[model samples]
Target chain A: MEQTSGTQRLVLVVEDNPLTLDAVVAALDEEGYRVRRAVDGMDAIGEMQQEVPDLVIADIHMPRMSGGELVRRLREWNVPVILLSADTNWSRTAGVVFVPKPFDLDHLLDVAANLLDEG
Target chain B: MGIVELLGVRSAAIVPLNVAGNRRGVVIASSAQHDFFTEEDLRFLQAVARWVGALAHRAELVQQLTAEAAERGRRLAADELVTVLAHDLGNYLAPIKARIDLLRRRARREDRQRDLQDAEAASQALDRLRRLIADLLDVGRLDQGIFAISPQAVDLSGLARETAAAFQAGSNAVRIGGESPVPALADPDRLRQALENLLSNAVRHSPEGAPVHLDVGLEGNGDGRWAVLTVSDQGPGVPPDLLPRVFNRYVRGSGSSGLGLGLYLASRIAAAHGGSLTVDSPPGQGARFRLAVPSGDELSGFRGEAP
Candidate 1:
C-alpha cells in the first residue's frame, strides 16, 4: 500500500522469524513507506527481482542464504542496505548501514528515511 | 675381559648394575688368588652397587619432579594474569551493559526510536565485549585445571554438521562432509565451543564466496580411536614459520584481528577431553585445523571433572 502523507518509497525487510518480520513491516508501514517482506536472503533476492526496493534491511544469520550473502549480491545494485546482526565485527561496506539486533524501530526508520533522502 | 685377566685376578665378585628397574651392566671386582674373594666381599660389592643404583634413580626422579613443578608454576602465573585481566574488563563491561539496557528501555517508552536504536547498538557491542571477557576467563579456568567437562555419548558428526551450518554466510561457504553417528565421549557444550572457534577462524580467513570445509569421522589406530573434526578454509594459508605457534595465546596471523585466544582455548578444551588440536597449512593452499577427541570406548576411566 502506498503512503498517503509522503512520497511512496519501497523497502524490503528480510528476516527469518515471522514475528520480527511482521513487526518491522508494520513499523515501516506506519512511517509511510511501501514495505515488502521476505523470510530470508534467497526469498529477498527473488522479491528484489520482481521490484527493487529503495532500501533493504536484513538479518546476518539465516537458513539457505545469509544476510551477508544478500548484501554481497545486492552490492551491484548500489541500493542502500541496512544489516542487522548480533556480531559486532561485521565489516563495513559502502552504501550499507548496520543496525544491530534488539534495535529501536524508530532509529531504523530514521536511517531508512535518511538513505532515501540522500538518493 | 682382557682388563680382568691383565689384573691377574683368579677370583671375582660380580654384581648386576640396576637403576630404576632397568639393568645396565655388571660391576666386577677381582682378586689375585683363587677363592680370594670371600662371601663378605661379594656382599660388600652388592651393597655398593645397590647404593649407587638407588642414588642414581633418586636423582633422575628429582630432576623430573623439578621440571614438572616448574611447568606448573608457569601455568599458574599465566592463569593468574588472565584472571586479573578478565576481572577488570568484566567490571567495566557490566555497568556499560546495564546503562545501555536502561537507556534503550527509556528510549522505547518515550517513542525515541533513534535513541533506542543507538542504545541497542551499544548494547550489542557490550554483549560482544562480555563474551570476549568470558572466553578469557574460561582460558584462565582451563589453565588452572578448573574447567569442567561432563562427558557423555554424543553423535559427533551431527554436531559438527550443525556447527558448520551455523557459520554459513554469504561471503564464506561452509560445507560439512562426514558419516553420521560418529559416536564420541565428550562434554557436548565444550566440544561445540571448540568447533565454533575453528569454524569462525576459517570463515574469517576465507575470501568472499570461498568455501570452508569441515570433515568429520573416526581416526587413529587399534590402540585408540578419535572422533576427528577438521575445518579447512580456501584463503591465504598461514606462513610456515607461524604454523607451529598458531594455537599459542595472543598469537594471531598477519592481517587478523582479536586477542588470538580462540585457538588457544579451543586447544585447551580438546586436551581437557583427552583430545588434540593440530593445524596444517602448505603456503598458498589455505590452512586446515583438526580436532580429535576420544570416542566413547576410548574414554574409559577418563575423568574430566573440574578441580
Candidate 2:
C-alpha cells in the first residue's frame, strides 16, 4: 500500500534464487511495494549504500555475501533487516526479524507491513 | 596367574580397552610370566589414556564438521532459488521490451494488426515469467517447510483434462490421448499445476503448430498396478548428456527460458501422490514425461472426483 507521503513502501530483497527472487518481487509489487533486489551479500551492501530502503528481506547462505554478514553489516547502519532462511536455526540470527523459509505469503507480507510502519 | 591359568581365563585383562571414550589395543598379563608386569606398565597406561582422549576429541570435531558441511550444502541449495530468479528473469524481460518498442514503431503507421500479435507474444512471455516466479517462491516455501500440501482425493484424469484445457486456451495445441475417462487419487490444484507445467513445456519446446500430446490410462505389470500420465512433445528431444539431469533443480539446458524448476516441481508433485515420475528423451526424437501412480490399496477417506 502507498505510504502517507504517497510513495510506495520500499523493500530491498536479497535473494539468490532467480525464480523465487522474482516471485517475491512480483508479489511485493502486487502488494503496492516498490522492491529492489540484491543477489549476494556483497551486492546487498553495495546497494544499501545507494538506497535507504524502508525494509530489507534477505535469504541466508548467498554466494559472495552471506545473509548473516548482510544483517551484521546493515545493523552497523541501524537498518532493519528481515532475515529469511531455511536453516533450522534461522531464528538465532541477531538484530533482525527472522522469518522461517517455506514462508506463508500472508505472514511475510504482514511482517513486512509492520516493519515498514514501525519505521 | 600361570601361563596355563591365563590361557584358560581367555585373557580377561587383555580385553579391548575403551580408553577415555576411545578404544585402544588391549594388554594381556600372566603372573607366571613375571615379564608381564614391569615398571613401565603404569606410565604406558597413562600415556595410552591421554592419546585416546585426544583422538576421540578429534573424531568428535570431525563429526561436527561433517554435520556442518551437510547443513551448509542444504542451505546453499535453498539459496540458489534467488540466484536463478535474479539472473534469468532479467534476461527474459529484456527481449520483451525490445519487442514492445518494435511494436510501438509499427503502431505509428496505424498498423494495429501486428500490434495485437506482439502484445500477445509479450503477454505469453510475461506468463512465463509469472510461472517461473511462482515455482521459485513455492520452492522457497517448501525449503522453509512453510508450504503444506493439503491432501484431497482429486480425480487425476479430470484434473489433467482441466489443466490441459487451461493451457490449451493459451495458444497451445494440446491433444488428450488414451482414455478420456481415466481417474486416480490426487491433489487437484497441485496436479493441475504439474500438468500445466508439462503442457507449457511441451508447447514451448515444439515447433509452432506442433501438437502436444497428453495421455492417461492404466498400466499393469506383474508387480503392481499403475496410473500413467504421459506428456510427449514432437520437438527436438533433450540431448543424451542432459537427460540424466533434467529433473535436477536449477539446471536448464540449451534454449531454456526458465529457471528450470518446472520438471523438478513436477517430480515433487508426483512423489507427494505416492507415485513416480520418469522421462525419456533421445536426441532428435521427442521428449516423453511419464507420471506413474500406484493403483494398489486405495487411499482411505479419499473419494475420487469423476471425470
Candidate 3:
C-alpha cells in the first residue's frame, strides 16, 4: 500500500538468514512495496536513519544490535516494527508482532501484507 | 605357550624385541585348565613382539581417525554458520560495491550497462541473504529441540507428489519416478521437510536443465521391512572419500550453498521415526539419498494411502 501520510512505503528488513530474507523481500516486492535489508540491528538502524522505511522486520539475535533495541529505536521514531524472531522470549515484548521460526510462508506474507496495508 | 594354554586362558601377552616400539607382540600360550604362563615362554614371545606391536599401532591409528572424523562433524555445525555469514555477506557486499562504483563513473555508455548489471546482481545477493537466514533459523530451532512434529499415518506417495509440486512451482524442474504403495507412520510435516531438503540438494547440484529423479517404494532388509524414499541427482556425484561424511552437519561439497544442516536434520527426522537416511554415490554416477522407515504389523496402524 502507498504511504498515506508521507513518501512511498519502504520496508527495512533486518535478518541474518539469507533464505528467509529473500522470501520476505520477494513477498514484499510481489506486494508492490520498496524493500531494503540489513544483516544486523546496527545496520538496520542506520538504514532507518537514512531511508525511514515505513515498516521494519527485524530478527531478534543480530550481531551488533538486538531486535529489541531496533524496535525501541523505531518506537521512539513512531515507525511500525514487526519482530520476526526464533527466540520465544520475544513474546514478552508488548505491542511488537512476533513470528516464530519455521513459520508458514503464506502466513508470513499475509501478516506482512496486512501490516503494511494498515500502515 | 601352546594352543592348549591359549584356549584355556583366553588371554594375550605383549613382548618387546628387535627395534624399540617396532617388534613388540605377545606369544600367547594358554591351556584349557587356565594355568599360569611360564618364564621359558617369554623368550619366544620377545622375538615376535615387533610384528604384533606394528599391528596394534595400525589399529590404534584407525581408532584415532574415527575419533577425529566424529569430532569434525560435531565442530562443523558452528563453523558452517560463521563461514556462511561471513563469506556470503562478502558476496552480497561485492555487488553493492560494484553498483556504487558504477554510479561514481557517471554517464558513460559502458558505465550505464555496469550500473544496470550491478543493480541486478545486488538484488540477487539480497535473495541469497534471505535463504541463508532461513537456514540459520532452522538450525537454531533444531538445536533447541523446538521444532514440533505432528505424527500421523501419511500416504507416502501422496506426500511425495505434493512436495514435488510445491517445489516445481518454483524455478527448478524435477523428475519423479517409481509410484508404488509406500505408507508408513511418520510426521507428515517432518517427512516433507526431509524430502524437500533432499530434493533441494539434488536440484542445486544438478545442471540447470537436468532432471532430478525421486523414487518411492517399500522394501525389506535382511532383518525387517521398510518404506524407502530416494532422491537422485544427475550432477557430479559426491567423492568416494566424502560419502560417509555427507550426512554430517557442517559438511558441504563443492558449489554447495547451504548451512549444511539440511541433511543432518533429515537424518534426525528419519531416526526419530525409527528409520535411517543413507547416501549412495559410488564415483562417476549420480548421488542418491535413501530415507528408510521400518515397517511391521506393529506399524500397520501408521500406514496410510499408497503411491
Best prediction by DockQ: 3
Give a tens-digit lDDT track for model 1, residues A1-119. Answer: 32453357888998775656776776676567788898888898899999988888887666798555777898867788888654333525555888755455556767878888786
lDDT of 1 by residue, B35-112 (tens): 888789989999999999999899999999999999889877876666445534533443355456556766887899
Cα distance off (Å), candidate 2, residue A26: 21
Across residues A18-113, which tens digit of lDDT does each residue of candidate 2 receive? 656776776677566788899988888888899878888887777886555667788876767888665434565667888755454556778988
Count of residue pairs whose backbone atoms collide, per candidate: 2, 18, 28
Show where candidate 3 strays beyond 4 Å. Answer: A1-119, B1-131, B137-150, B169-172, B295-307
* Model 3 chain A poorest 10 in a row by lDDT: A1-10
Q: What is candidate 2's TM-score against the reference?
A: 0.47
Model 2 chain B scores worst on lDDT over the 10 consecutive residues at B9-18
lDDT of 3 by residue, A10-72 (tens): 888888767667766665665567899998888887887888887888777768875667777
lDDT of 3 by residue, B39-70 (tens): 65666676556566666777878998999887
Q: Please tell me the interface RMSD, in Å, for model 2.
A: 12.3
Worst 10 residues of 3 chain B by lDDT: B98-107
